[model samples]
Target: MKKFILIVVFSFILAGIFTFINQPQAETVNRPSDKETSNLFESLQNELYEIYDIGAFKTASNPNYTINEIIIPINGSQEYYDSVKDEVESLVKNIIKTTSFKNYSVIVEKNKLDQFFNEKAKDEMDLRYEITKTVHDSLYEAYQNQIGDIGITDSAQQLIIEVNTFFNGQESNDFFKEMENKLNIIFQEKLSSNLLVKESSITIHIYNKYGERIN
Candidate 1:
């Protein structure tokens, strides 16, 4: 009985040791210290700013010697971002290739300053709607004034301005094309002269009764 108890105890001890030896070891993630992360981010920031017109590096994360996330705060309108997006993308790609990092990504996020610009854009668009209405009304009036001399009659409710260049003895396609071209010039000049509407944002369309564009 004593020998059997000893054998049982010895077997339990051996099993425990074997189990400990076979267990998976916990891998240590060597995340960079806060100071080290800040320094590396600052260095990268200096290099980036030298070539690009952009804001500072808001935050960075480098865990286990791998640059995980490099966040950059952008403060500009959509148009401004569009102009710089390609350059920023190229810069990030170059950095990812040259830097010794296993995994990383750059984020260019819009900040408070950009939000302000976005609000401003919204305001401009609201005003633009009103300006467009003014342009349409003014163009309709101008079309009415010129249509009589040009020998055409058009409905007031309709936006189409039909010119009777087709009836003015020169029935060739050239005459109609020339008349349309001249009308376009006149309308463009009138649109440009308007104080309420932006000439760049507005376009005048001249169409015949057959739903075809004259100009």
Candidate 2:
């Protein structure tokens, strides 16, 4: 009975050792460090700069690091960007393949710098308009008596000032010119005084009492 018990105990110990050895181990995920990520960003940017005028580097990634998105802003016209978009995408894909994230689904997108800047300038001008509302209102009030209904609009990189005069008939070209010069000076002076106002060209449009554009 003692010999049989000893055999069974040895067999049980062997089974436990085999089970522990064969059990699958948890995967050790090597998440990228901050320094590593920065290096990768620099490397990708440098590669892109070699072929095109890059605006800025933009990237998005999830915690799992399975999906990565890179938005590359190219400084050129729409035609040029569209022509080279496929090439840019292929270049980016090839470069990414050499990295440890070879299996990651990399999505690349290209944007035109002109469109981006235009949109950004408009947004900035809108913000400035909101910030300098008091100044605008004061200027309008000061000029409303002289230049019958005055309307001001901020468009991209220009400040459009529309003046509807209370003149009985069509005004002379010289008259409109003089009015434009005067309003330009006043508007520039008042707007320039405010630091929030960006450097923008002023356009003056004059309309007669009959709603006909005089200038």
Each model's lDDT comes to: 0.55, 0.66
Which tens-of-lDDT digit does each residue in 86-201 have in candidate 1? 66756765665644332456677655666887797787566544444544454456454433212222243223334321133424667556655655665566544533333233
Candidate 1 achieves a global lDDT of 0.55
- Please name the candidate that would achieve the greatest lDDT relative to the true structure: 2
Please give the clash total of every predicted structure, in order.
0, 0
lDDT of 2 at 22: 98
